[model samples]
Target: MAITKDTFKHVDYLWDDEKAKALGDDQVALLLYRSNILGADLRITNYGGGNTSCKTIEKDPLTKEDTEIMWIKGSGGDIGTLKRSGLAGLYMDKLLALKNVYRGLEFEDEMVALFNHCIYDLDSKAPSIDTPLHAVLPFKHIDHLHPDAAIAIAAAKDGEKITNELFEGQIAWVPWQRPGFDLALQLDKALKANPGIRGIMLGGHGLFTWGDTAYECYINSLEVIDKASQYLEDNYGKDRPVFGGQKVASLPEDERREQASIIAPHLRGLASSYNRMVGHFSDDERVLEFINSNDLEKLAPLGTSCPDHFLRTKIRPLVLEIAPDTDLSDMTEVKAYLEKEFEDYRQYYTKYYEDHKRDNSPGIRDSNPVVILWPGVGMFSYAKNKQTARVASEFYTNAINVMKGAEAVSSYVSLPLQEAFDIEYWLLEEAKLQRMPKEQPLSRKVAFVTGGAGGIGKAIADKLAQEGACVFITDINKDNLDTALATYGKDTGSGALMDVTKMEDIEKALKAACLKFGGVDIIVNCAGLAISKPIAQTTEKDWDILQSVLVKGQFAVSKVAVAILRAQDKGGDIVNIASKNALVSGPNNVGYGTAKAAQVHMSRLLAAELGPDKIRVNVVNPDAVIEGSKIWEGEWAKGRAKAYGITVEELPAFYAKRTIMNEIISVDDIANGVFAFVGGHLSKSTGNILNVDGGVAAAFVR
Candidate 1:
């Protein structure tokens, strides 16, 4: 058939024949190539939502005879990220024979265990529940994708009629059936009856297509999805604005961000009550359009039609009621209203569990909703970590597209409540949950580290990241900051430039951190400056710069960061990196020592004032961290060496000799002090000081 530029309106054509030919004749290699490209585009399929497979001829080890083997995506991985090890391989002859042992629909689940007997590769990953769907199909190459446009057509009230009319008999429609052996048998039957059809829409589920070659299968999948998307795009907004026109105006961008900073933490706390959850925020134009739409209240609670979205976003999102341009300036008022809604959502979810639960059903999972929507602010998705939370938000965006398409041509329809309940409490899903590893101590926590590219700060960031905290780092040096971020890796939240003494810079950085990972739970004030000069030699400029960076910087960071912590209502940590000189009386250290002293007292004061809020404040004093410290890179080191009556190179040993233990202190040692204060080890200890100066007797607090 003829193709035009407009043919792929919602999705893109990514296949390259040269690249495919470069892959040689390896069928599995070709399948992986196709799966990765298809999964790479959200318009084509959501993460981990679909499966692909190909039946290949391989020699059986037992009989040394050519046998058919099917390779499909494993039980738990995104196709975009799939590797060779992520595919499950089974002997096609054995898989097809399982039909003989299957009793009926009542015993479909038992058939899953029998799949192990069909394994062609001993090291292959556990097969997906959808394995049967691919195994039973007769096509050499098959694609089962959860595309928003196709699912939109499948979820309309008269989806079957629409399918017959839109595709003109090229694509067939099948009634919704749960994914398992029974669905496999039904799909086989449907394909048998309509041998001429190129694809089938599983009502309210997804789309399926096939071809003899991998390239043909890929093209067919794209053409079918693109066609459905084009039809929906043409129909949508033609009659009226999508979602029945916007009922509420979106808040200005600045106001929307401020509102997210104020409200995300409370919602995060609610999501974490069952288990601490990391958060992700989205204000994409589409997300805002849907959240502010007149039909938001009507459509959000109907739940998603696709199973992937239902699982990721929960059965229904917790939608808040707020009139357009609501006054959200007062956090106290917003908190009161939010608490009421949060509790109500929990009660409603628990009631849903009690309403539909069977005797053998797993006890209700976290009652808190995974996806929460506020009219003007946008969407907040909370999950085990940043990646999961981000994917959850993306899945909801896909659902929004599906809803728009369905509502455009016909009324949008969701699955029966019973079907949603069954999927939610599925034993197979619980088994997958059981297989996950235990979470780290700080798995769901987020840390904002100031001066994070320097010695103490970088060490602390690395340590926190190792413990599974998503850390957002800030450094004034662009080169250092970029290098630090590269070293930290992507799983660690992210970073931005900030000069802590500048309010605008601090506000911008804090806002970025909040938007990046919802909000901050740990604050590390590690930015510092040193001006070690005798009273006669010290200049006013030296004192001012030292105080501005060391004392005022910490204060400004706390003033902004504390607001985020208190808003989250989750107890937090604030570790002030001071120095041994804070408590010790030393010559040539007037300016630096005074700033350190102020930082120490400021932390104690904050600890006292914030105790009621459960925000712990503490201090870590490290002396002679000369190896990697930026402070030792300039005049300060020379100034200290002169006062100690030693060469610059001997200053390290001099400081070690001054300590009781006579040992050098390192950056990692200071990092340990910060961790001890915040790692739940000193849960009740606050307003205290830990000295990492090899037992500095003079620095010990009275």
Candidate 2:
């Protein structure tokens, strides 16, 4: 079921004959297109280190006529896991047109020309290096691979002989050839020699097979690999491979832990000093075992699974084999080891350059090992990207497996030191370092808060402004504008008297803020009014005013904020204050509840629509806080007591006792919640409603 080498070969051989039988035909073409060759190839090879293609007739979107095209894997993608953009389409006629103009041009340029044809003719998709091979293939489906078995046998000293023994009369074999036109040409010659061969194996490289259908091609590739893997497994799997020359005893956990704790501080210091925050490590048994082993020196080098990955994880890991009590935290110990490793690398580079000519511009890297496998400690994977982090892990994992096995046969030998250096410092590799992302608490920031005059909105404004943000505050009362300016503005904060009801006023204020602050990064609409008239006595006018401010105001502010935030090209955050009444309707507060409910729903809708621009919108529903507002003192507090048939003095205690914690929600607590929504830590959350209410709302108030 799961694809492997055995299944690949079976499919490859069957599809080869099947394709030969079908030949060039319209009906067979449909069958070839139906199989999941891409999925099969990924399973059989090192994570899409293969390529699969079909010569198909695709109708032009505008012209509506069939045009012959060769669909090949795009550059920078593994065929083992093909994504939508992984495959690029090239006009067959244009690619074939280049075959005549070939007069030994630069391989990269020739590739560019072919790729350019795809870009110019079709939206400029970067064609794979194997595009020429696919273009030349006469079959409907062609697959290319670097099966582990084939490559292991090929990279061995006597690859040619071993390959002959493995295939016998069934497959064609080619000598070691570089992967571009040269390999394609060599493959052409070998295919011609066998004529009736089922598949072709490129020595020291990989395997390639083709068939009429995608399934046949995938199966053939699988079967061939299956046979090779069985042969290797039989020969090698009898016992675990051992390292030769020296064997050291592993350290126990007590010693490793002591060393780890001592070493952890230094590592933490190194990361912190370098401004890299090292995440906490959760120890696992296997990780502990690997760290305390003695074969660490043999583990670093056997790492390059593919060519490009070599740059991400280098050719080896750093081996630290020492006694359990070794004090790694001591600067003398760390520095001496670091220097010795550096010196060894320098010597290796000198030797490597003697054999291969390489330029100095991208010269030698500082050559700091990204992964270090401590003999008594587990390995560490380091990289700027999470993808590279996994790449480092995989590289080290495979290297350890191969070297551990090789130790039995002989000491593990990695790629020559200079060879690894040359690749690491190569121009292509150096290019990856350009244009690194910036480090900022809030990069290209902006914020918008309604009811900016008081309470949670002001706290949010202060928090955001502290972390390098420009804030825009709006309130219906013009009198509060000057005070907010004095408080939040403090030279950076700007206030406006824009009622959230009037879209025009909201737009005018937001436009001015964008012009003044450059753009908006976050929006916290904390402005809301609470009137506690019983439902039977609540008037439509009162309901309308509350809804206009709570519901329509949120919609208006967010709609305009979204436009400014999107144009700013920096992501935005919108936080709205809905009362806990929105969730649990209270008696005599029908108007307030309905308006707040609308505010909550609109926040969710805006969050979804604005997600494309990376704008986040969330609602915070807080319980009654009697610190600052007249609403808290005059109506809300008194009304709740009347409803409960208690004195106003007893209302706070009544609500506090209703919660499991018997704790009351404070204005400061609500302010802190709003502050978090507007700042650095809660950046990823959107459409999340947080309840800052005590037990009366069961912690579901927000």
Candidate 3:
């Protein structure tokens, strides 16, 4: 669709005259409206990729005098979700004076300090790097963005000529220059020379449009973008390739999951620095088409489609030579192949950086690849956190689309290497990168919680997430799993239906976790069952049910998880939720007690076997944790209460008073003990049992 004055009319403008008056600041309201409009359309601007500003009058904090202020989108804030706080207010007079100070400023750091000092409100967020351009542009409102359509024209070889023709005399052109005081001055000079120009297109970068009001500025941006879109449609519509191509057969879902389960951990190990990296897979049709293309080798490595993307994804992605049918089971071979590829990529990137390094160039970033294109399989994005991985995935996906569009229209070209280095090293961009909160202790760590729908398992998953771990929770009951996921938030915790009694279901869940969060670093075997009855009354079916869920199920899940953890070669934790019944069986609890006993023994044995591989296995034996515990609700609570000679309502107090400490064991209490084991709080202790029984003498193993 061609952008017109009414192109975005369908979008809900959150701010109208009534709301603007209610807000008491029409400029800020209009700025919010314009930012949301631009941000709403990915074709106009993607996440964290655009800035908007307005000139208004506000009372100065220091002088208490009305002064002209420039309110612009703050650093690191997404425009679509921009709030009043997201826009920093600066004294226009003080900001415009930075042009004089720019004459002496040699370092970007000094300019940043100067910009920070110009804030009209000290409590406001830092202003955008393009503050100078916005301040000098003379318009009451301004919008700057890296719209895909505009980028297609800007990054082309004949971009200047095409842009001139498309906009006629309505727009001016700025040659490629790193955004700074100098670029701002150049833009001001160009606009002054051409008094009638409505916008400016920066070669190899983005577009800028402005007007007297927010609506006019927004409409001008749309109109410019629409022209570019129309040009591409007219010229390249026939040449653009269809979405589907050679019907490359895909592996069965089961087989693909198995393969991803194995390969993801290996990739995680190869990409890890001091901390393990997480992986995110994309089977997006665009990604698949790019990877499966005959020209992938030629097209994939030719730098990012836009310079702004360099900050998130670097210049290019690394393409691994693995296919869907490749054997990822041989960890040693896979590791070696990946290490070699990484080394080669490092050498090539280092040489490229050195060749293009300028006096002001940012130094080289880590050699690790952010986006990895695996032939025959979908692409993967790696990062120290899931959010970063998702961001890289998005930018790379956009880069692929832009390149494909450019190739279809004409030849695909990118900004010069030197320009990319400028952006990568640009102090403003670098500061934005550094401003992200420090990685938490378990920032990139992934944890899997079986039986996580409720009870102690749910608590354990919540604790893991609190410590910065991405948690994948599973339960046989899909409804319970859904509820737990909703409470924890789908972003922080994902869920899958898993019946521990079924080995195939166990494998499928493990693979799903691996594919979802790259790999698992910690596994909590919390799935269990209880069948309380006298040995004579307990049928064979009851014994099998308890044994299959508590004993055999734990064994199956642990075995598969340990294989992945070993491939990761990273030290991992396994915390099995045993029970106090294992140490001291209650009356008629033969099956449940025996199953819990087997779990404790299995944990100890696995600890011994996996110790050499740095995998720690430990057990948290919780007793009478009746509060918020699904295990102790309904019939189980009634049965246990009957055994204790008390009503169901009094069962918790009865169990609490039975212990010497007279403390009620809670799910959080058990979760805390498990945390001590999994968080490496007891790093040196393994094959050990932690008791959360509130001083139950009968449960004391030592």
Candidate 4:
């Protein structure tokens, strides 16, 4: 990849022209300050990874006098090469009003008011989403970036030591924070906490510093990143690891359009929901090679460049390991892969936020990574425009390299899941959310559940039915379906009897469900049999029955169900009931556990295969669910009781006490886990294992 001259030369122009541009006069100096600071801001980090702004008094045509407004960059303009037209004006008074007043305002509302009140013209590009930070900063010029070198050192084990030695006491350190409003608020609090600070090192992020002049701000970024880069060159790996591989070309135009068509719907949903345009493309060869890599596990670390970048990049990019023997031109397969990938991203966000936030305000800025990597194709970054995409690419490239270096020294530790969530969804983070618009991608959705008689299946069925969805509750046992109808039947809800393992039965049942509800929005495969026995003692008959119940049952139902869901045009959601044993091997009960494990993989494969149709598949791994079901009282449960050397009555207690917190795992808890996934709240989630196990058998108790 060739580095363009515009990338470096344009930024350095300020060094020569600064003195010529402004000799004095405060307003002219401020403009010069902004121009110089912004030039360095762009080069300090990657393209769109940094921002610079100047707050000054300008005459308001409507007010007919001098009024304060913030001249911030638009969403996609690169800070380093930012032109005069790139700046979006924001009302300084409106921002000042929101500075200390924190309640009764939503994320999008604040953003809208800030943008609308301050912008010079409505036709111009909206103010940068980082407007809040500028609003809060007291400096005449502000510069911030995810500097590659600085973060590399700051993320290390000896980061504090190195950071202390590098700048002495000039820099104040901020722990990693999800960007947006919460980050702005945190910086505000930090300033209050420490009276005088010229620079801030955001752990795991990059660097933030401001000065009275643009030159100072620009110098600060270069000096800091250069210092850290030199330190890394000296202390890190002396021998550079070779990235030997074939350089792949960009996707052809037709292929690009095909890719766009497949992902456009979901992209639109994301854009509408977040109120941020989601312009994206997969053009990079390295990203494509990475996505198309043979190893799935290795792809986990290729997330966003920084925590805040997740808003654009998502948690991780999709891996496109297209098999040689497979149909390469199948756009359906491509679509399936993308949808499935998005679903899991949503699940991760939900689980991350669940146990972390103690307060229930808009807690982390929801940052989902937007990059996609195709095995044979190149990697792609998503942004509102070309500039933002370039920024994402640059930051991600540097971050990935640093991560490689860190891995060589010692493993890079991720923030605790809950703590990560706290930053991602904090009240202060809600500012970004407010800027978004309302979206209903799965609107007019209707769903049906098989084996909606008891336990996990019934819980999922009931929740969807309550969420304005027309639901069909089915069971092989007529009595159970009858009972379900009696309990839940309402305007659009109904019930029926069908054996999901039987194809004819599933076909007939789905026909009835569609006829009654007009179409299906989702499918929940909740039907399966449980018979636990050791592999050594297991008979061929037992294995057959178990596989028949778990795998065949799901296959039979989904085959016809997918057709109906596709016709509806609205995307569908699928939830499968899996056990904790599926994740960790089950003890002794090889027959049941093995079959269940296969069921999990089956869901995953289905997710990968069915995603293009906008149908998502996910598995719910519940541990020790013992409510509203005969499984708890069946002979199988009694046998397990004997194996554990406890009576059937004491078994629940045994499982409950096994967790670190000694919290009992209930049916409702499992239900809630399923509910979060099935709800539009997790629209981008699928092909994931959600453990609703209440801290089950953790190696260490916190």
- Model 1 accuracy (lDDT, Cα): 0.88
The C-alpha TM-scores of every prediction are 0.95, 0.53, 0.92, 0.44
What residue runs in model 4 are displaced by over 4 Å at the alpha carbon?
A: 1-43, 46-48, 55-138, 178-198, 239-302, 320-370, 374-377, 380-395, 398-402, 405-702
Number of clashing pairs per prediction, in order: 0, 49, 0, 49
RMSD of 3: 3.1
What would the per-residue lDDT of candidate 1 be over residues 127-221, giving only the tens digit for each residue? Answer: 98999899988889999999999999899998999998989988888899888998898898988888889998999999999999898898899
Error (Å) of candidate 2 at residue 465 is 21
What C-alpha lDDT does candidate 4 achieve relative to the native structure?
0.62
Candidate with the greatest lDDT versus the true structure: 1
Sort the predicted structures by TM-score, highest score first.
Answer: 1, 3, 2, 4
lDDT of 2 by residue, 132-174 (tens): 7666666777777766565555445555665677778667777
Q: Which of candidates 2 and 3 reaches a greater lDDT? A: 3
The residue-by-residue lDDT of candidate 3 on 29-75, one tens digit each, is: 88897788678877787788878999998887778899999999887
